[model samples]
Target: MRQINGQNSTSTIKQYSSTLLLMGSMLCSTHLLATTTATAYNANNYNAIQQTMLAEFALAYADTATALHNYTVLAIKSNSTTVKQRALNVALEQHDFKAALDIATHWVVQEPSDVPALFYLAHIALQAHEYELAAESIDKILSHDPSADLEKILAGIAPESKEDQTVLVDALQNSQAKDNPSILVIIAALEAQTGQFEQALATINRALKKRPNASNFILMKANLLSALGDEEQTRKWYSKASRQHKSNLEIRLAEVKYLIKVNDSMLALEKLEKILQKWPKAEEALFIAGLTSIDLKQYERAERYLVELRNSSQYQNDAYYYLALNAERKGHYETAKAYYRLVDGSLYAVSRQNLINIYTEQQRLNDALRFLTQERVNYPQHASFLYQAQAEILKKMGNKRAAIGLLEEAIQHLSDDPELIYAEVLLLDPFVQRDRLDQLLTLLLDLEPNHPAYLNAYAYTLALQNRRLDEARDYAERALEMAPDQASIMDTLGFVAYLQNDFSTAAKVLEQAYLLNDSVSIGVRYARALYMQGDLGRFAQILKQLQQKHPNDPQLAPLNSLLIPPPMPKSS
Candidate 1:
C-alpha cells in the first residue's frame, strides 16, 4: 500500500483496527440491543449492528475494500462525524481518491466548521484536478481562520501546471475571499511563479492597497516589473521601496541584489556599505559587498569584507572561495591555493576544479594529474568526475589515444559508468571508428533511452555519416521533445534536416539554434542551410559574423573559400 503524505500504512491500519474494535464493542452492548421500541425500528437497528460487525470483521482481516464499502454506507446513513472520518481514512488508505472525495464532501456538508474535513476535501479535490472545488474549500478554510497558510496548502500543485494554476486563480478571484489581502497575496505569488508578470503586478498592487507597507509585496512588485522587461520601472520601485522602508534590512538587501543583477556594482557596493554601517554584523550584506567588490575589480575592498566573514558559520566556505578568487585575480598564487584548500562543503568541488585549472594554466600537467589521483582517493564520491578531468588534461597534452585508454581502464574498475563511457565515445574519431561509436551509443541508449544529450549525440553522429537520415531524424525529434529549449538538440534536428535536403526546415531550426547558442558548429550549419536556401544576403551576413568571431575555427575554412574571387585570366 502507498503511504499517504508520509503517513505509514501500518500505523494507519493499526489506527483503523482500534476504531473497529471500539465500534464492535458498541454494537455488541446488550443494553442498546434490548432498548428497541417498535419491531420496524428494531429490525433496522439489527441490520445496522450486523453491518457494523461485518465492517469490523473485514477490517480485522485486512479486507480494505469490504471495510470501505460498509463504512461509506454507514457514514452516509448515520450522522456520526466519527464514522464519516473513519470512512474517509479507509478510502485514503485504500488509495481510493474518488471515494475519499465523496466521503470528504459529505463530511464537510454535515459539519461545515470541521477544519480537518475541509482540509482533506481541498487536497482531495486538487488530487482529482477539481480546481474549482479545491478553491471553494480553501475559501471556506480562510473564512474560518484568516491566518491559514494558503501557500502550504497550494504547495502540492506542481509549479509547471500553469493551466491548473490558472483555473485555481480564476476560481479564487470569484470567491468571497477575493478581497482578502492574504488570498490576494497568494494569488499574486502563484501568478508570478508561472510568469504572468502583468497579472501578478496587478494582483500585487491590489494587495499593497490593502496593506501598503507590506515589504514582501513591494519586493514582488519590483521583481514583476523586472520580469516584464521594464528595468527602468523596476529600478525606480526598488529605490522607492528602500526609501520608504529604510529600516527594513530585507528590502534594502533586495535593492542591493537588483543593483548587482543590473551590473551596477558600484551602486550595489554603496548600498551594502550603508546596510553594513547600520547592521554591522549582517553576514549576507557583507557577503554581497565582497562579491560586488570583486565584480568592480576592487580587490582590496573585497578582501576586507570577505576576511570579516571568514569565521562566519553560515558563509565560511563561501567566504573562503571568494577570497581564493580574489587572491587568484591579484596573482598571489600561494595565497589563493591556501584559501582554496580551506574551502569545503558545497564549494569544495568548484575550488578543486579551479586548483586543477591553475595547474593546467601554468603548464604543470604532472602536478595536476597527481592532485587529481589523490583527490579521487580522498573524495571517492567524486571519482568519476576526477577521472574525466584527468582524461581532459591528457587530451589537452595531445595524447588522445592515452585519454581514451585511461577512460576504458576507468570503466573496467567502475563497471560501465555512463559518464566515463560517454566521455570515451566523444574522444573516438567518429569517421574512423564508426562501429565502436555506434556500439557505445547503443549501450548508452539502452542505459538511458530518454537522455536528450545521448539522443542528440547519436542523431548527430548518424547525420555526420550522411546515412540513416530517417532514424537520425526520429532520434533528433525525440530529443527535441524532451528538451525543447536546448539549442544543441535543435541543432542536431536541423542538421538531420539538412542532410535530408530539407533546406527550408533546416534553415529555420538552425537559425533559431544559432540565435540561442551561437556555437561555431551551429553557426556553420546555419550558414550552410541559408546558402542552400538561396538567401545569399543572410548567408553572407552570418558567414562574415562567424569569420569575425571565430577566425581560426576550422569549420569556417570551407565557407571562406566561397567568398574568394576567381583568379583573373592572364590572357585578358
Candidate 2:
C-alpha cells in the first residue's frame, strides 16, 4: 500500500494519487462478498450515512480505515452516482488498487458514456497487470474521443518486473489498442526501456508506416535511434522529419535540445529565436533561450528572453531567479536584489543566501545585521542560523568579543542546537578562552561524538595549538572516516601528521587535500612537507603557483623565505 502522510484533505488526496491506483486484492475480495449480499434498499439511510462520514472526514476526525469502510458500504448499497464515485476516490486514497478497480468497473457499467470513469478503469487495470482489460477500457475511452492523446495515460503502466512489463506489452499488442498509434508509441517506449532497441525501432516504424507524415511518430523514431547510440542517424532522421513538417513545435524543441547537447549553443540559440519568432507565446522556448544566453555569457540577451517569460504564470518565479543571476553577473547589485525578492519556491533559499552574500561583499555589514534581525523575527524557525550568520559578519569585522556575545544570546533561545553550539565552540579561541573551548568541545563531543564537523573542528584546534598529537590524530582519522571526501578534514589529518614529524605521511595526505581543493592554507602545508622531504624543486614550484594566485598572501611569504638556497660562491 502507498501511504500518504498526514494529509486528510480530499483535494490533496485527489491531486497526488490520480493515476494507476489500486486497492489490495485481498481487501477487495473480502469487501466484494459483503457488497453483494447486504445491499441497503433504502436511499434515505444511505444518504444520511454518507453525510455523516463526509462530515467526519472533513473535520479531520476520522481515520482512513473508517472513511474507506463507510464509503465502501455506500458504493455497494446506494445506486447514487455520487456515492459510487466517492467510494472509488476513497479506495484510491487508501492505495487499495483492487478495490479502486472493482468500484471503477461498476462506475463505468452504470455510466457507460462517462469518459473519466472509462479512463479510471483503464488506469487501475493497467496497474493491476490486467493489460487486456486495460486495453479494452482505453479503447472505450478512445471511441468517445478518437483524437484524444493517450500517451500520458499509457505512460503510467510502470511494472516492477521486466517480465510483467513484457506481459503488458504483449497484451497491449494483441488487444484492441494494437491499432492505436499512441499505444504503439508507449509499447515502443517500453521496449526501449528494456534495452530492446531493434524491437522498439520496429514498433515505431510500424507506427510511421500507418501515418508516414506523423511528426510525433518521426520524433519518437529519432529518439529511439539516439538511445541506441546512433547520434548521426538520429540527427539525419530529425532533419528529414523537419523537412517533412516544418512547423511542428515539439519537433523544433527536440531539435533545439539536440543542438545544445552537441555543444552547438549558437545554432541552438538561432533555432530557438526562430521558434520564438513563429510562436511568440511559447513560454518554454523563451525560458530555454534565456538559460542558453546565460550559458553563452550573453547576459543582456538573457535578460531580454527572461523578461519576456515574466508574464507567464508557470515560469515567472524561475524567470525572476535567472534574471536576478544575470543582473548580479552584470554587477547590478540593486537590480539583482529586487529580482531575487520576486523569486519563490525552492529557489527562495538560494536567493536568501545570495542576498546575505551580496550585502557582505558590498561591505554593508550594518545593513546585513539589520536584515538578519528582521529575518529572525519573520522566520523564527530559521532564527538560529541567522544568529550564526550575523556573528560571522561581526567576527570578520574584528569584533570577536561581540561575535561570542551574540552566539551566547542565540543559545538562550535555541538552547543546545547543534549548529549554534558548533559555531560558538569555533569562536572560543583556546589561548584566550582555553577553559571555555575545552568545556564546549567536551560537551559537544559527548552529545554527538560521531559528528564529522565537530570532530574535524576539535582535531584542527588541538593540532593548531600543537598539544596532544596522538589525540588530535585520532580525532582527525575519525572525522575522515565519517567524511572521507572532505578536503578540510583531510588537511587536519595532514597537519597533525606534520606536528608528529611524520613528514612522509604529511606530504601524501596534504597532496591529496591540495588536489581536492587548491586552497592557500592546504597549499602552504603541502609545500612545507615537500621542503622538509628535500624535494626542493617541487616545493619551490608549488609555492610559486600559490604566490601567483595569492600574491601578497602573508602565509606564502614565511614559507617562501624558508626555501632560500645557499648563496653561490663568487669564485665560481
In candidate 2, clashing pairs total: 6
lDDT of candidate 2 over 1-572, digit per residue (tens): 12222122223324322121122222333455456556535445535454544634542664767767666665665555455665766687667778877877887787788776676777778767787888888778768876655655655456668998888888888777687777787788788879898999999898888777776778789888888889889878877776667788888888889878978899899889988999988999999999999999999999999999887889999999999999999999999988986776667667767887899899898998898888787777767767988899899889989999999899888776878888999888767787777777877898899999899988998887889889989999999999999999999999999989999999999999999999999999999999888888889899999999899889998897787777988995
Please write out the lDDT profile of model 1 over residues 358-450, one tens digit for every residue: 887788998888888888888888788889999999999999999988888888888657888899889988899999899889988988999
Q: Which ranges in model 2 have alpha carbons more than 4 Å from their true place?
A: 1-62, 80-82, 142-146, 154-157, 211-219, 240-247, 333-338, 341-344, 355-367, 370-386, 407-572
lDDT, residue 539, candidate 1: 90
- Model 1 misplaced regions, further than 4 Å: 1-179, 187-213, 221-247, 308-316, 342-349, 430-439, 450-572
Q: How high is the CA lDDT of each candidate model?
A: 0.83, 0.79
RMSD (Cα, Å) for all candidates, in order, is 8.8, 8.4
- TM-score winner: 2
